[model samples]
Target: MLSSINNIFGNSKKKKTDAIQSAVVAYSIRNGKLTVLNEVPEQSVKNVQAETNGLVLTQGFHKIGGSFFYFEEPGLYFFSFPFQKNSLRIVVGKDAIENALLISNTIIRGNKDDEQSLKHLKKEVLDRFLVLTCTYACIFVQHILNETGIKSRLVMTLTAEEENQYNDGHTLLEVYDTAIKKYVLVDIDKKCVFESDNGEKMDLLSFTGAIKNEAKIRIVSAAGFPKLDWAGFCAVDSGFNFQFIEQMFCYDEQQQLNLYKRICNLPVIMADNKYFSVSSATEVKNSWKNKLNFLPVEEFRQKFYPL
Candidate 1:
């Protein structure tokens, strides 16, 4: 079913309108209707294309986009792939999350320090949310640059601490700030990245370079996958390749509990429907290990848990 949806939605061609391509198109998907808001201040608001079943037809034309649709909407809906160079991605905010919570406290309801909690967390958050980590800490931040009405792409980078072998893997976003004419590094998970020319502060490469002691860099773009590619209760995209993620390691359930409790207070918030398609526990574990070496979940808990 997901494959069929992808087959239809994925069939995109080059659009002739540069205005639509570079414009910040506001979109919303509700009750199977996909609507696009493309209007100039003096111009009347018009829907360029309205597709049934909420599949985005304009993937290649626009590099940046926004959606007002709430993920908590209970129904089957197709999400356009985030693989395009200038594709628009949805933002997961607080209100939408809080609203979902009202419907079901089970969204994020569990103790942060138990293996059961981890399972519930995965079921509620990890499964739906992509867990992005950097070198120091896992922080979730949000920032919207209103500079040009057109949204910009954000690049989320992951660099290994040991060899500094990094995978640019995934477009956290590709933000084009033409007015500033400067590169901006956004912590997508944190949802906040201050726009500044201070190369030293927002410089992820510099920090990794200092640790790796190498000037040369190798990075891979980890583009987020569409809903079809993700493993879920109903559908599965077998062709979807799971990358970088490996088995999650722990001595026992106790350790797992500790780790969960440790990061519960951190800036991480598991939003709705942000689950990963890779539902395998082993895969998640391995991915966690690959990203952050087996520093014993217990160690983190011991370090951060209130004494």
Candidate 2:
């Protein structure tokens, strides 16, 4: 059934007023079956001839030549090869020249149903979607990291969010969380940090401080705004950390301005100010390695280890 459809509408050609031509290569699937339809009209044939004549004449040949006679019609036409059960549709118009050339080539090459062609198309679509998602996520994560003044490598986890909907596949998120000993607490005014294993309190000095030398940290939020939050953090980590702090805290040019500011803002043993920090670096790193065991880390090992 699909073969028949492809035979009928797999290729279409159309002509334009300027004598240029356009062609459509399309196929449809329905009810687990595929069909190809002819979408070209008759007018395209005349256009094809005109274009061919123009090209040939431009080369300084008075006599029109080479497939010039094939553009007699001005609309769509259907044709079937000898011993072929399926019929193909071609629209002839000003656009017919290019369309004709393409259809002719397809006929000669015999690649209409090549496995490589299908695979190429599928890969193109997948690559496009992946690029779009990654770009958006990167920007969003950077922004959040800058605002929070946290420094940590942001790695994504592929975890299923919801079940298949309307037969579509599940949704996933690239995520990272701090180790079990690492804990974080935040308030409206300032982000408080604490360590579960050490019982020590460390205030979040800046976004860069959060992830700079530290191994990892857990991201916590209500269930919504996944893309926005992730993009914010990624933006900061990518480069905007110090710039963000400068905008929020103005200071004169000093060699140790950032460090000075952090120390100045440190919270005393005051009430109503909460603090959040990680428990232990070793425990956090181990937990993350266990959770992300499926990642491609062989390259990481090679880079970190020379021999």
Q: What are the clash counts of all predictions, listed in order?
A: 44, 65
Question: lDDT by residue for model 1 over 167-205, one digit each (tens)?
Answer: 222223333334454333333322323312333222232
Candidate 2 TM-score to native: 0.15
lDDT of each: 0.28, 0.25
Q: Report lDDT (Cα) of residue 258, candidate 1.
A: 34
Name the runs in model 2 displaced over 4 angstroms: 1-210, 213-307
Model 2 per-residue lDDT tens digits across residues 36-92: 434444344343422421111121111121112232232222222223222222332
Minimal lDDT window, size 10, model 2:
53-62
Q: Which model scores highest in TM-score?
A: 1
By lDDT, the best candidate is 1
Positional deviation of 90 in candidate 2, in angstroms?
Answer: 31
